[model samples]
Target: MKKVLLVFCLIAISTLGYSQISGGIKGGVNFANVDADGDPDGKTGYHVGAFLTVGAAGIFIQPELLYSFKGAEDFDLTYIEVPILLKKNFAKVLNVHLGPQFGFLTKAEADFGGGSQDIKDELKGMDLSAVVGAGLNLPGGLSAGLRYVLGLSDIADNDALPETKNRTFQIYVGYKLFGN
Candidate 1:
């Protein structure tokens, strides 16, 4: 876990040297659910992260690191997620993004009237998903986007349990450290 974070930081630091490279902090609400019995029920959670974008000729590659809180009802799961997106800028105002996202489980717990109990042992360590979204580019590198994350792998660890997959809707606002 530490090594993964370190690598992300290293890439972030390296992006600072280029005029076309920008990185920033982002945080927003997440409507997360599991696809067990259809839409399932979503618990509103939050995600905070940092992202770096490298662009050339209106095309860009963006990498983001985020800590996201997911799950709902009786259980809550926390994850450290990495998303690498390919973006196409249009009219210098809107950008469409699509790519793969990887998630590492950091914590898992169940809440009852009594309190909370750790359930990490029963959970899987990794999650893979697909992300698709669009962002509105603004001055000063401040931007906003709405995206959906659809799980490509089942998160269930036991065969006895139902087939579970993640579904998340995210809306975020970001501001680059340096003006564009």
Candidate 2:
């Protein structure tokens, strides 16, 4: 058992060292949807975040901290979200990603025709989602990625109320801090 543990530890360390573990900041726009019976209203919510990327031969792990706003038209729901993803690289410039995401609600607002109102008490404060996407590395250390985030947890607290989940499409531009 000791021999096996030692071997595993060494392999883990070597893998980390082999992978390009780079940290940087990222931010982007979220095209968001509140999943209703039909196509939910589309609104542009924004997000800003930082990410840690660990990339190796053909795989990478990216974990991000983001402030995200997502909701349908006339509503503004904001939260802080954490997403961890596993990525598979197909080429030096292209990769695919998928993972789990969770969020804590910070604020909620609704636009009445004449004014806006807060409705934080009526909704759930926590959100959970699954994310999948792909990315392309561009010239000058710039990278672009698109992700689809599907909400798994209901946003409504009352079971009798209509349950709505969120679907968000995010496009991000990232810059690598370390060069290859």
Candidate lDDT scores, in order, read 0.89, 0.87
Worst 10 residues of 1 by lDDT: 12-21
What are the runs in model 2 whose C-alpha is more than 4 Å off?
1-4, 37-40
Question: Which run of 10 residues does model 2 get worst, by summed lDDT?
Answer: 33-42
RMSD in angstroms, candidate 1? 7.0
Task: Give the lDDT of residue 176 in candidate 2.
Answer: 73
- The numbered model that scores best in lDDT is 1
**What lDDT tens digits, residue by residue, belong to model 2 across residues 1-180?**
999999999999888767777777778899998886656578898898888888788788889999998888888889999999998878678989999999899998888797889877878989999999999978877788999999998997776658878889999988777645
Candidate 2: lDDT over CA atoms? 0.87
